[model samples]
Target: MTISFSELDFLKPELGAEFTGDGVHFAVFSAHAEQVDLCLFSPDGKEETARMPLPKREGDIWSGYVAGLRPGTVYGYRAHGPYDPSAGHRFNPNKLLLDPYAKQVMGELAWDDALYGYRIGAAEEDMSFDERDSAPFMVKGVVQDPNFDWDGDLAIRRPWTDTIIYEAHVRGMTMLHPDVPENLRGTFLGMCSDPIIDHLTKLGITAVEVLPIQYFPDDRYLLEKGLRNYWGYQTLGFFAPQPRFMAGDRITEFKTMVKRFHAAGIEVIMDVVYNHTAEGSERGPTLSFRGLDNLSYYRLSPDDKRHSYDTTGTGNTLNVAHPMVLRMVLDSLRYWVGVMHVDGFRFDLASTLGRTRHVEFDRDGGFFDAIRQDPVLAGVKLIAEPWDVGDGGYQVGGFPHPFREWNDKYRDDVRRYWKGDEGMIACVSQRLTGSAVQFNHSDRGATTSINLLSAHDGFTLADTVSYDGKHNEANGEDNQDGHSANHSHNMGWEGPTDDDGINTARARRRRNMMATLLLSQGVPMILGGDELANSQGGNNNAYCQDNEIGWTDWSGRDDPFVDFCGRMIAFRKQHGCLRPERFLNGDNEGPREIAWFGEDGAPMDEEAWGQAGRRMVVLYLAKVGTNGDTGKILDQLLIVFNAGGECELRLPAVNGAQAWTRVLDTGAQAPFEPVAAEETVKVPGECVLAFQSAS
Candidate 1:
């Protein structure tokens, strides 16, 4: 019962296809377009039935009202304008464009030459416009009913101090899971499956920071190489949850997953990419933004309008300076939080969002100001990648209050100290104490630093100890891609080895690093398969590896390590001294706790701090309250880490405690043992030992 374009109304201001009781209102912003046409297709999306030219234009937005347009309608847009790439107006009406605000897309982008704006192999390049109709090859927008019954489900709102972020890929987390059903595997529903929920519950994880689940297209080059984007970093739609990841109804299925996680008291934090789109570079396709208004959508070079200012290293950067673009970003974020019910977001390359008119990252930028002030985002957690390729983009300590920045210093120093580097003692000391130098400022607490050992962008924990350099030959770049400055020590071997001694040392080092991460004061994040000892065959950057190389191999492997990791996480949660909200202090300003000790059982002096080659130290933490109240003092714990040879450590004398009890020994083949602590305890090389006071 669709009506013709002759009687359509044009009075709406809200963007996207907003469904009222009897009609759907549509609006899109395109400042440089001569005209905009709404293309409505059949249910199958094979034939276009109506091409309704927008009759109203108000402040760069052309909108109209379609009567009797129901929820399952398939549609797209076509902007008719100049074909001049030099001026950045690359509008090609023949190439149907995707709606940037589409909540549910109908199809996938089929890789073909017709999808491009220019002639495929012409010498004129982007200057040569191709008249081929690209509607057949492009993805179309689906009118989605974004309604769901939460039935009293609400945000978990776990405090930052209690959160344990388990970063995982949505598909890779359960694609090969033995317990997950075959039909539900590799989908959003898989995350709520019994096996996955049971594993997360046992591990004591409070929040699962999932990798990018936004609508993304498989890169054409990756397709040619017979690989795909396993990481989903290259997003094509900000508002749409990728349909491939959905099992049935897009909106309802995602809401069900979120409800189940909420039922288990686990929050879902999404890793999002608002930096760039799939339509890349000057020679790339003329998709939504490019075809609609390229000049307003992308930041072009000041020297040349034909080129884009790509600080993200992703061909183009979204122009947030423009008000319309900023509004779109804001709306998209709100939709995810309000409509979709996600708890938080981890912004990839967040420094780019703060870049200003002077081409510098401003802490007081519009994006940050808008987000912190937004009523909906006030309670949501915000984590930043903290650094980008732009100038002065390494903002580890530069973020404002309440936003946690990923601390790369912690990653490097902890790895170096456990690897037994020559000059790592001082650096590791700061890292072990929640990286106070980088995060402790302007009322920002220690939890402002998100400490992580390995993430999806880098090697898994297994490969970190088994490979000295990145092995990315399978990425089809002749192994020239990925970071080369991996401060990794392979324990005298590259990749996997049959030598038992080397494997033992590697396992011990992993335990040592894991112990240091949990004992640190900042919020800790664990890469998904690190607990299961998942290996990528030494592939550090497997962004393009969608096969077994990127999937989590959940077959028969080391189960003891997984148990040990769970125990460690539980221990950290139980102990308050390990995760104080305030930094270590001596007065009422904060919690006066945590002291470093030498092997001789004395306070760490200047010489001990300066001992660059020293790889052994004892950590004594006062199990006291953060208020510095002297009335309620709990038992103190002593943690010893030995990266060198086995040393007999003399126990430290507490204020009012006598004998100690050994709780964990990573060096032993059977870890997590209990022993009556004597005056002196022998700690094995490349091992971690924990002891608690006995009254």
Candidate 2:
């Protein structure tokens, strides 16, 4: 039975008179409430409260239709029901609440006790409900038309093998950039500007994965501590983009950013947090999901109905195991890809999505299966953070096929090797070659691993070699919040000093780690400010600090560290053999690609790998050939890595190759130039050298 607009008794025409009869319908889902009122606010601060008793109630789903509501209409909801805490019902008629299906949130939430359904300082806490009206404090959701003309904009769909990802914060990336305009900085439009585009294109990265852009709120705990939620992990509204990031009219601004990125031939991937929401544990405030349906939306422990299952450690985890809950996640993903034209998604703490009602990880979980079979979402890129704080939540190499995972092992192993750790040669070798042991057996290839040394969650590359432990006094957590096992080794000092030997050692270690990341076989991801030696003063986790500690400082433009990053990325693009989708079989099936060698100019032996204090230089050579197998051989590229002190030995001679030329030397003086093939290039003490073999 088709329902017509005129026949719907709750129809009201005010803000959107243009599309009243145009087939657009409004439906909202609220389970516990007896009646839901739709309140529309005018531009002059006058409100027209429309009382619409839900026409139908199907197992707590109270939905109704309202015609003539279009984009830019400010509206909210007032759910009326019993106020009980022990039974998990916290509904209050006086408190105004945001609609769960809000497409866009207009402004920031002003802090006030009226926003909470329960009394702020009541003796019984959330048990006693307050009758104070919260209409002035809550943010209202705007009804968006969801109509945009995307003219020939399609996902670039770059394969993981050939992709290079650059992890950046949307606001911090361009906040201090000298090239961007003053007004555009710290907004979505600023990131898509020509200056930012030119920088990313010049670096040769294929994709730009921004941090959480979904509408989130600054937590009360953070606000009381004089801090803000800068990382955006504390999501409040899943369907709406954060109003702070919006430059103009909410919906069109985000669409414009996507179009601009598509025009630049760059793919946009968002870091999404579906594992939990901003609403904390049972004692937390009554927000959208919790206030709507606590039993259906969150995964509550059977033993204790008063508390929620805290797998995310963010107070509550979304019950993706539920059928309707799973639909909400899938619907949100498709909306971004279909309507917003986003290229990919990187799930934050994705392991929670695979948990079942029994609290066990399932490989064939409903969330994973649904996305794999989705027609529109199947073709796009899917990435996973691969872990959570739940019981049995570490599933790094356990993700299903057609999905890439952020390899934490890669980050740890690379750090240990560069820090001069003994017995790490064998482990480092496996990681540098894409960890075939972890991914090769399955249908996934080398590209299944997103390799990196440092990301936004941990220590920056500069601080990794300069501090041994986390120094988070500024975070107000008494330095007890972040990770304790950093596996970091400062050269000699605990913090910054003027010691030349220690400073030089730190610089060499940073270069070694960066070189390994670029030369690795899997897809590489570089943190935003690591190029200029950015540091957070040894703070491993800066989730709440939005000040200079998190922003990028471009003042170090003249430093050699930044120059090295620029050259390293350029060198990787020039050599195609380094980033292969599959492991090197050593049979020359594809090309005379990668050749492993020891310091003695011979094949690497198992004993050599086990020996302590032994560093090996891997020599990689890629020969170019035509599709017809009848073209001139292209120049052979050679990379030499020296992780130890200065040493002299006979260099390995290429088979059927006469000459080699030096292309890049990490230890060279100013005006470094490529040398002749016959010229013997001295291996630096702790540096990498790139050469070309041409006959």
Candidate 3:
């Protein structure tokens, strides 16, 4: 595969492994490299076959056209340059680099001390450069052809208004399922099987917001601790699909999953972590970007270039302010949407991506501007985990249009109110109606809020009511790693209870929260196992626990919970008022809209609306009529919240309606069964009631 830099097409700056008829053209960005060698490995990825130098450097890119190289050709790079850590140039030719644009990787990195650029036992720490070869322990980028029939596959493009997200791990979702086949069980095809599809459809989820399926490294620390990084947040390669998720052919298998999901009318929203790489601080391994160009790829500290200025709380933060680095991220996103046929993205630590050169987060930064302007990305759903672990990182309400942010405010307020926190009515009211206080700006509609009770990083829905404190003991961090401000409350007894009364209370509380989430006015994201009453025994932070602790159990133990979720989801879809377009300004001009009421069955005054510690309230919704006019003529709903204690609700008369029908009663023995909404309905304490005006 070796050729003279002058003889072949070697200087083309398109960064990636590109298969041209016969040979594959490889390119990488390393502005600081004096020389870069293209190290080709054997098909088995066991040994290095040849080392060819790319003498031609166009701008920051080093590229070469290998003559006989074809698809599945494993390769890495050794960029030759200065080894000064203080200067932020930690280039050691011995360390192999993965192509930033690698469509697929051939092997998994085997953790070893030899993989470090510095000697393991050296006193110089990172200052010492080891001459040992890291090629044997490194993973090589596979030269994937990127040509799939696709079978006319296209983006599902389900609007955010119509979308209900289900956050799930590719492995954990179907890993322990008795229905999914034994061999296919934790793979991509396994999740795409009939059983999973039926479950999602029944749950009324329009999109599967899967946990990171990108190529990631199982960290050395987690491995030593006898745990695995199950969440896959620490990304190793942004472009490649995780090889572990594939059963047979990687590209085809992934495409098949997406295609099958599309066939089921379900959109796939990939949870991508572009904010940081798996490579940690100065002490971490010289994997990909760190080996390519450390200073150019990572945000090094201004005072000390040897240390990284991390914002994502991951050991290193990507230097997206750099144009080429920014381009790499933009290119990776496009590849996922265009090539992979993914409908959208749920960006982990997304605030890190929107960081500007001035060390502050800006909505109109390069990362955002690129996506907004790109034709491919503009149409897809863009969700942000909106905050990072840096200064000015809590930007929950600051994202621009079309970027739905993860609304932590909604989660906290909802949890606090249901857990019997005083003075939560004001905040809870805002959250119930899409948090208009946070998102009512710049034409940002209700869909701007991606509301959730729980996600992968925190407690699942079931655990929230079962544990008052985080139990992350399995992570080997002394049970001190997860969030302390959980806003959770155990119902009488803590963990599992034998008392029928306590279990009944916990079950009702779960229903209360689920009903609140589904009936709320925003894009509701359900944690995968939540609908089935899944719990991790109070382990809020199970990021490193890849075993049954993190996997969802599908023993149908919570068939009642599942049925309730299905009915509620259907009820949400049947009504238009739940997912309104504009903020309810009390003008109620259109068809589907809202009107607030007090316990006295009268219009809520300013004092009543803002009153704290008020546990009971009434909300009236006027759904748009079927005649298709501006008038709100057709449907009407009366939602009641009684969190304080058991009380009788005198149903409000909406437009002189005679009777109301109970669509959902969280306190009832059979929550989903149709019950006639009486004039005075008795709602139990810590319960939520949904009623529609009977025609």
- Candidate 3, residue 95: lDDT: 89
Off by over 4 Å in 3: 1-6, 10-13, 588-592, 625-628, 656-658
Q: CA shift at 402, candidate 3, in angstroms?
A: 1.2
lDDT-better candidate, 1 vs 2: 1
List TM-scores for all candidates, in order.
Answer: 0.96, 0.91, 0.97
What is the alpha-carbon lDDT for the whole of candidate 1? Answer: 0.85
**lDDT string, candidate 1, 1-695, tens digits:** 55554354457666887777676778899999999999999987889888878778898988888778888888999999998888877889998988889888877889888888899899978878989988888888888776788898888889898989999988888999989998888889997888999999898899999999888999899898899878888887888888778877565777788889989989999999987888888778877898889999988888888888887988988888788888898899899999989999999998988885557998888888888899998789999999888888889989887688888889888887887788777788788778888888889997888999999987888888999999999998999998887678898999888999999888888888887888788999999999988999888899998778898989945688888899899888878778778787633333336777899988889988888778888887776742575545554678887888978888988655578998888877666778898998888777888888786
Per-residue lDDT for 1-695 in model 3, tens only? 44433366455546898888778787888899899998888888888888888856787778878777779888888889988899999999998888888888776789998789998788968999888888888888888877888887877787777888999999999889998998898899999999999989877889999999999989998898788888898898999988888887566788889999998899999999888999999999998888889999999999999999999888899999999989998889888887889999988888898886568998888888888888989899999998999999889889887889999999999999999888887788899899998899988998899999999988888889888888888888898798999999887778877899878888888898999998899899999999988989899988898889999988745988888888888988898778787776566444435777766667778888677768877777775654565464566778887788877777776566678888777877777677886677777777788887787
Q: Deviation in angstroms for 609 in model 1?
A: 1.3
Model 2's lDDT to the true fold? 0.76
Cα displacement (Å) at residue 652, model 2: 3.0
| lDDT ranking, high to low | 3, 1, 2
